[model samples]
Target: MGHKLRLLWAAYRKIVYVYLLLVLLPACALLYVYFHKASAELERQVAESMLRAVEQVRINVDYRLSIVLEVSDSLILNELLYDNLAEPASGYRFDQVMEQRNLASLIKSLKGHDILGIKLYVPDDKLYAREHVHFFGLSEARAQPWYGDVMARSGAAYWVSTRPQLYGAAGEVQALSLARLIRDPQRFERVIGIMEILVPETNYAPILSGAEFADDAEAMYILDRAGRIVSHSGASRIGERLLPQPQFAEMTSGRSGILRFAHRGEPYLAIYDTLQQNGWKTVSFVPARAISRPDWATSFASPLVLILSFLLLFILAAFLVFAYVTDGMVARLRQITSRLRLRGAETVGERIANRRGVILRLEQSVAHMLTTHEQLVADHYETRMKEREAQLRALQAQINPHFLYNALDTINWMALTRGASDISRMLNTLAQYFRLTLSKGRDLVTVEDELNLARAYLDIQQHRFDNFTFELELDPAVRECRIPKLTVQPLVENAVLHGIQRKEGHTGRLLVHAYASGAGYAIRVRDDGAGMPAEQAERLTSGLQGAPGPAPAGYGLYNVMERLRIYTHGRCRMQLDSAPDVGTTVTIFVDRLPER
Candidate 1:
């Protein structure tokens, strides 16, 4: 028996090792390949999303400046200002004191949200400075930095905010100024002066808002042609030249698109585009790891770990079963050979040849020892009885409760202290989910309790999903309102399974919003998933009671509707609004509930 056991153990080891090689290596390789693909795809989506946001910022900036451009276009149409600055205004022909009033009126006509100050540089400086209007000499225009660019523009307009002296209100007053070269066509198109219109920094600064990607750490900026920060969420950064960045060369290369590079030894993604109106770059800078790790990578890790863990358990189980079966067969061979030796049978067939396989020799020896049919039948019956007894014990073990809840509590504690807080949190949430679900078998539950159950379910799902996120909003007044116990959970499940999971590429959002309406309340479950058509959405809201067979599509929704109808005495109705590729929104409008 001992020798036979050694043979079985050797074969068991071979099979186990071979099976592991077959399963583990391939699974790991496939996981690596798929993970690479998913990471690349996720990074692309993040880049595209960031690019669109930055592009929107650019459009906003362009739109604001275009409004100012319109004011410039309207100001250029004023012939009186051009005539006033054409040359020294006739002191006898026009009121010298009223020339300031005349210029101020021109500034007022051109004034809107776009203009704060208008400085006209005249060669013959006769007029003094006013609140909105200022007259300077050709030398004054030469002193300004953007003056050359405005002159180089020839007949076109130019916008400059690169330096402080460019502003009429010293350097302290920061504003985007539009400069246009005023020319006299009647005087052979000779240069008259430079027209400068000032727009306060506060105007477009708020349009940058607080928009960011991934988190607040990710920054969005409107940069000038000189690489200086024009408009930023942080006001202090305005006019400051952005510190030398590695990608600054690539970004300034004038090809507006996405690029990736490392900053400070860490990877970063830069999505930049040039604004057409101002020729400024809108850069949305984000950390590369921030865009990838928290999303799908987390989703992959947990599932991969669970699968590998199960594979290990399976390998162990395989070896255990192999050992168990081999022990029984080898023991039977020993019993047969011992009995034959006592009965004087010819040494239980030929002496086991080492040349033949161990299994083959054992088989032949057992055949000779069991020559009598009666002894073999007796051994078989005994072996069957042993197996039956073992199965009965295993059955009892499986059915026994063994204080499952207490075991879970022990596991929760073990996970918590060992720095597996995530596991502990998931286990606690799961336990709470079950407790809330049962609710002591109560049918009606407060809106708050129902939302808690939904939240618990979503929290657990969040672990498995990397690209998925959800929000739960409950108005304080609606928390006490009672609704069906399991209503919200099923809806959330439907949204996650049908909506978020089915969504292709990019993050999925599930929102459960509950609030008081008029005399009653409303519950909204929305998902940015692969939304269905209006007809399909309408069909989904219909209860399945009259259907011929099981309709898997609408079953969960139908149950919720029926439960709500019965619980609220027909005071509630569910409505669905959905559009293809846009999203789905399911609203439960609850009428006034009767007092118990």
Candidate 2:
């Protein structure tokens, strides 16, 4: 008995030391993984919060700028302004004064809560008026860049800087101006004068400042076409150029959305949005530290405390096992082993048979754990796929063909009344094109159906252009190949209008062909007009494929690419090739539809 007790003590001491060493390493490794995961989770949460806050700021800024543009459009297209510009300068001079007074009253009415000041520029007299008073001489007005740009564009509205001459003496020097040419209705060919509006920075400050986030977050700003700050929460930074360095300049050129940059020695997360209509950019910034900071002690301390408690329980359990099961079982087991060795090998076999029941129970427990792990993995993957599908559907829902159709109809009617038959016919064709576009009930349509729609569009365009010609060559085998609806029409239209119309005296040729390639079908549209430069073509493709929302090129191509990606599981192919003055070709390839 004394020898057995001494042997048990020595064995127990060695087992306890080994167990502690084994448990300690795992416990430390677990601690490291726990903290590392917690830090990563913290960073993701911060980035998401910052993105949401900056997005809200972007919405507010867009709303404000939209209001400004709307007001500017209303003033430029005002009947009184148009009537005043129409009449000859000699007999209609007094009439112009009365009209100007009425316009001033209208401006005051429209200015109820938003506008800071209004101005009108007459190129002939070099005369300019703001809030009912003539301010600049003809020579002085002509010298201004805003006047030159308004003349250069002929009639389209443009945004400009509000200097002291046009804006009120008390008004802010750095204000936004909207200018458009006032054309005569009779001829519809002459520019009579320019109309301008000076919008105060204070009106936009609220938009820049109202961006809300956690206390640690910062607001965003907008850079004008020249890269000068137009709107910002920080007043001092307004009008200063932010992208003076080559790196920032490169970053700003045609790039949009969330980016990281260091400013004034602090790292910041910036969300940038470029306004396609105005060539202006809005950027919001939050401190990187603010976005990535984690309360490590708070987030990880609870888990660590639980782990420590678990270790305590494990230690107590080990001690209990040592006192109860180990002390008794190991002693008995050793005695049995010694007896078997001294006597015969048959006793050893009998002892091993008795332990089979315990080993069987352990096997069942391990199998159950494996089954649970596999189920968890499958559930995670299913959840992720569903989330991605939902996002794609949401994006598809936002493409509104109705608004585009309405805008086209308006342009068509305006052109018809003005006797610009070519422009009117083009607008009508565009309207008909989109009408069919909205009619396709399904998001996906056959390649044959899409090509027929493109042909209908081209027929109308051909009537409008008179000299432009096009041909289609489709492989009968691939005609029924599935593709997104209205995909090819816009590219064809771009080729006709931008490529063909701008070229010198020569017949324009547009060729569209489709054929089978491997397991997919390839559709190509090539034009023999003034082809785009390589850089411009790159920009067009990048914008179509990469932008988050509807790109300005046309919602059709963007929608098509997105749908193809979803349907083909990223197997669809899109390519663009073009050379200046040669031509442009756009190709799309997708999986062939299964036979009916």
TM-score of each: 0.50, 0.47
Cα lDDT tens digits, model 1, 1-596, are 89976887777777868877998778788778877776787677657656666666666676678777767765665557666666565555346567767876787677676677777776654645323236676776786777778888985878787344354434565677889988874574688767788888777666666457465452777788778887676777788766365457778886478888778798888788887776888887778887676655464765587567769888778866677666697876788878887887766576644331122322333353345344445654544444444333333233212234566789999998999999998899888887787665456788899999999999998887867889999999888888867788877887888777777884689899999888899999999888888777656655434442244648777766755766676777778788887778888888984353
Model 2 lDDT tens row, 1-596: 78976876686777768766887678778778866775555555455444444444544555565666667665654566665556655445566567666656776766635566666555454222332353332344576777777778877778884333334455345567677777776577876666666777667767766764435533667777777788766767777776546635654665465666677887766667666447677676567665434354555566667667767988788767666765498876788788888998875466422211122322333454455456546654554454455455445444445446667888888998999998886776667666666553465667777787798798887876678888988899887777766578777876787678767764589998988888878889888878767877777677666763333443555666766677677778678788978887888877555443
lDDT of model 2, residue 557:
55
Q: Which parts of model 1 are misplaced by more than 4 Å?
A: 1-16, 91-94, 129-133, 165-171, 216-218, 240-246, 252-255, 328-596
Best model number under lDDT? 1
CA shift at 427, candidate 1, in angstroms?
Answer: 93
Please give the range of 10 consecutive residues that has the lowest summed lDDT in model 1.
354-363
Q: Clashes in model 1: which pairs?
A: none
State residue 432's C-alpha deviation in candidate 2, in Å.
24
Native-referenced Cα lDDT, model 1: 0.71
Instruction: Give per-residue lDDT, candidate 1, residue 178.
Output: 87
